[model samples]
Target: MRFDQELIASMVAPNSRVLDIGCGDGSLIGHLSQEKGCDAQGLELDMKAVTQSVAHGLPVMHGDADAMLADYPDDTFDYVVLQRTLQAVEHPRDVLRHMLRIGRSALVSFPNFGHWRLRWHLLRTGRMPMTSVWPTPWYETANIHPCTIYDFFALCEEDGYEVCRWMVVNGNRQSRLAGCSPHLANLFGEQGLFLLRRRTR
Candidate 1:
């Protein structure tokens, strides 16, 4: 597991209920159930992923995240996770708002398309990025909308969502100290996990 995985895992208490949106192949859900004893359920759009989840004895529903968010009642789960899925959906902000309403907290993680390497590729080669992180031809990529690290925070601020914790993972960032090295944070913070709560104000 990477730092994002550790951050996501740390968000939920032991035996806490969780609902994972766009849960690919039920990997984390399986881990949470077997290792942490979490009560986990998953919502996935892909048939192959859903079938794989079911075969693993995981509670999974093949459904759209945008539509399915309205089905769950308020405060149904301790945590609602949107792992690497915000870009794929039509209305990410609406989804996040509803997720917070339906669960105590929400975790959102996305591949940062605004990484400097991606920027360099676009600027230098004038070609759509085809890297290890986002390995897809422009026409075939499932990513409808791409985003940056600060962009996500800006949305959270605009929509009155409180950021409980934000972890920018290069490999496994375990340091207590941080720096204002703008180049390092931007260039290296490839993936991030943002833990959010409803803003009371």
Candidate 2:
């Protein structure tokens, strides 16, 4: 499993329900099922990925995050996850709203656009930065709404969502203490993962 997948799986409670959005090839879902003993399923936009996942004996459906989430009843899963695909979604805010509504908690992981390397590259080279985590060039990239860690937190605040826990990781996706600080993480961390829920009004 990838480093982010390991961290995400660690956050999940054993034997709980999990729904993984944009689950490419179903590796994480399979890992969660075998290692964490969780009931896991996936929704993938790519039909090829869906087919591959099913052939591997994983339960994954062909669906889009923007539309399919509304079909699920509220509180349907213990955790709903959107990993590395938030920036690629058509309507991120709406997708997040539905995620938090249908699950007790939501786990999100995304590349941090505010990382020092990205900023430095942009400032020095005067072009979009490409790194190990964000390897795509701007023209062919799927990311339409890349955001910073601070930006994501601000959105959570504005939407009345409570950040339960958050972590910032290096390019290799290893969580480090220096990356735990909000300011430092925004500057140095390559990616961020957040666990959130709707705040009780």
Candidate 3:
């Protein structure tokens, strides 16, 4: 399993239901079901990935995150997870809202655009920055709405979502940065992971 997937799985409670959105190859769900004893399933947009997941005896459905999320009833799962795919989605705000509506909590992880390396690269080159986390060329990348950690916090505050937990990790070092201020995290962290819930009135 990927480092981010392991972190997401750790956040989930044992034996709880989980829906993994954009679950490529269903690896996370498979691990969750077998290791954590959870009722885990996946919804993937890629047909090849869906086929591969099903072939592995995983319960994965071919579906789009933006369109298919609303089909689920309220509180249908314990967690709705979208990892490394938030920036690629067309309607991120709506997708997050729906995820929270259908699950008690949501886990989100994305590459941090405001890392100092990206900022320095852009300033030095006066061009679109490319790094290990953002390996694609600008023209070919699917990240239409790249955002920073601060931007995500702002969105959560604006939308009345309670940030239950958050952490930043460096993919190269495989080290986590927790209990740090958001400003520091935004500058140094390569990726951000958050667990959130709808704020109670």
Q: TM-score of every model? A: 0.89, 0.95, 0.96
lDDT of 2 by residue, 1-201 (tens): 788888899999999999999999899999999988999999999999999999999999999898899999999999999999999998999999999999989999998999888999999999999998788999999998999999998999999899998998775657676465888879887889999988997
Question: In model 3, which residue pairs have backbone atoms overlapping below 3 Å?
Answer: none
Candidate 1 C-alpha lDDT tens digits along 13-72: 899899999988888888888889999999999999999889989999999988999888
For model 2, what is the alpha-carbon lDDT of residue 150?
91
Candidate 2 Cα misplacement greater than 4 A, ranges: none
Model 3, 116-186: lDDT tens per residue? 99999999999999998998999999998899999999999999999999988787343445327898889
Every candidate's lDDT = 0.82, 0.91, 0.92
Return model 2's CA RMSD, one decimal: 1.3
Write down the worst ten-residue block by lDDT for model 1: 174-183
Q: Model 3: number of clashes? A: 0
Candidate 2 similarity to native, TM-score: 0.95
